[model samples]
Target: MSERTLLVIGAGGHGKAVAEAALLSGEWQRIAFADDRWPALCETFGWPVVSDVAGLAALEIQVAGAIAAVGNNAVREQWVEAIRAAGLPLITVVHPRACVSAAATIGEGSAIMALAMVGVDAAIGEGAIVNASATVDHDVSLGDFAHLGVGVHLAGGVVVGARAWLQAGCSAGYRVAVADGVICAPGTVLVVD
Candidate 1:
């Protein structure tokens, strides 16, 4: 394949993690950032802050694809739409160390971080995030823009709705159905009685 350059939208902590995972995946030969902060935030982990949305317009010819690294689900979804509207391909980043079953389906623009485990038949939607060390059991469904923070655990058959944020260390019981836009506090546990 040709040398692919990935444009990461957002230059904050989450952006760094996404870029690092992309780097570890060895899918992109080049990576850069495009944040709203632009000039004031010139660099992130040594990668240049190419530009904001305006800069992205100029970079259309150079970047192979783009991924929204924003932490907020709504914001990320917006960026994803913008990137698509701009005619840039959305890229998915999966860390090499992540254990994803072959039967699992990871959607476009999603990120599966290092040490994350996605079991058989699990479906992760577009722009969703499975952070480091999270465990998604078999048959689980994570909706578009959903986020599973570090160490989050979801038992088999769990269905997380779109834009749901399961904070770090949160654990959900079997067949749990988390509603859309729900935000679970860190360490929260959802046990079905």
Candidate 2:
């Protein structure tokens, strides 16, 4: 794969992880970032943080694609829409160690991190983030921009709403419903009655 210029939207921890993955993949060069937080650090993982999202309009650079690296699904969705409106392509990042089933469907600009497992027939929506060691079980449907933090476990047939964030080590029971924009903190146990 030829090297491409990529932009990572969001400068948070998740964004950093995505950058790391992209670097390790060796398929992208000239990785830059756009975040709402202004005057922030100029670089992360040795890659320059060029400008805020709004600043992209003024730059003379050409970005081949972008990744919504925000941990919040809603924010991810918003950024994805904005990038799309700007005519930038959305790219997906899957860590080398992640295991995705043949029947699983991952949308554009989504990232499946190291040790994550996307099971059979699962559908991960666009711009979603499945963080390190997360497990998305069989038949699970994750809406657009949903984020699964490190070690998050979604049982079989669970439905996750758009832009939802299940934090580290969180677990949802089988067939559970995680509403949109919901933030589940780390180690939270979700039991479906």
Q: In terms of TM-score, which candidate is strongest? A: 1
1-193 per-residue lDDT for model 2 (tens digits): 6667789988878888888888777777668888777556677767778778777666567788888887666677778888888788889998878899999999998999999999999999988889999999999999888888899999999999988888889999999998988998899998888
How many backbone collisions does model 1 have?
0
Q: Report lDDT (CA) for all predictions.
A: 0.92, 0.86
Segments in model 2 whose C-alpha atoms lie over 4 Å from true places: 37-40
lDDT of 2 at 8: 91
Judge candidate 2 at residue 190 and give its lDDT. Answer: 89
Question: Which lDDT tens digits does candidate 1 get at residues 104-149?
Answer: 9999999999999999999999999999999999999999999999
Instruction: Tell me the lDDT of model 1 at 174.
Output: 99
What ranges in model 1 sit over 4 Å off? none
